[model samples]
Target: MACGRFKELMMASLDGEISAEDRAQLESHLAECADCRRELDELSELSELVGEIELPRPSQEDMMKYWPSVYAKIERGAGWGLLVIGVVVWVAYGVFLFITDPTTGSMTKFLIALPVVGALMLLVSVIRERVNTSKTERYKEVER
Candidate 1:
């Protein structure tokens, strides 16, 4: 294996997930290449440091800190922002589609196409909002 592949194997090896054959190849390359050997050493040190560090969680006060701002953003009608974003995205997509698709398709066909495309975009925006809400809930749960 080349030095690049050797580094990849070395990472997998450090994770205790590399096959024996791949491990042997990595070892052989490290023996022959000084640069790879140094890289492997640095990566191992980084892995050790990461393993020794502890992740800190939010305090109750810190968790409550953003509540006012978040609520204010919502109470101020943030839904309009979502609507605006949806319309912008739909218009951009429609323009691209119209430019690419020929004009010979009937006026009624084109008119129907616009709403269907807009509805699909609105559906996408709704799904995105739901996912974002779920993620926020998960984070709040973790904080508590």
Candidate 2:
């Protein structure tokens, strides 16, 4: 059996949340897997260290103050989503109209569309690269 499978069991056991059957199973696995036993010990130590610290609870007034800020963040995200959808739809409609115009020659439309397509491809590539880099770039905090 993979050591990964016992990880959750180890946590449950540490928390005293495991059923008797699972606790027995975990103990049996721990007896055979030295690595898992070491992991569980480390987790036990860390959990104890964390358990020693206490965070202050927010007062009702503090929580009331937070509601508007949390709501604003959610509202802003929805607003941006709607704006992007509207812009993309409008641009696509404009492009379709321009491409289908009887006055515009096929060659001209093709020439005009080439740059737009290239620009979109470049934009998408940049966004993908940024996303990939952001996952590992721990120093770039977004606070402004």
> Can you write out model 1's per-residue Cα lDDT over 118-139, one digit (the tens) per residue?
9999999999999899877756
Against the hidden reference, what TM-scores do the models get? Answer: 0.41, 0.57
lDDT of all predictions = 0.84, 0.93
Give the 10-residue window scoring lowest on summed lDDT in candidate 2: 135-144
Best by lDDT: 2
Give me candidate 2's TM-score against the actual structure.
0.57
Model 2 residue 50 lDDT score = 97
Give me the runs in candidate 1 sitting further than 4 Å from their true place.
64-72, 79-144
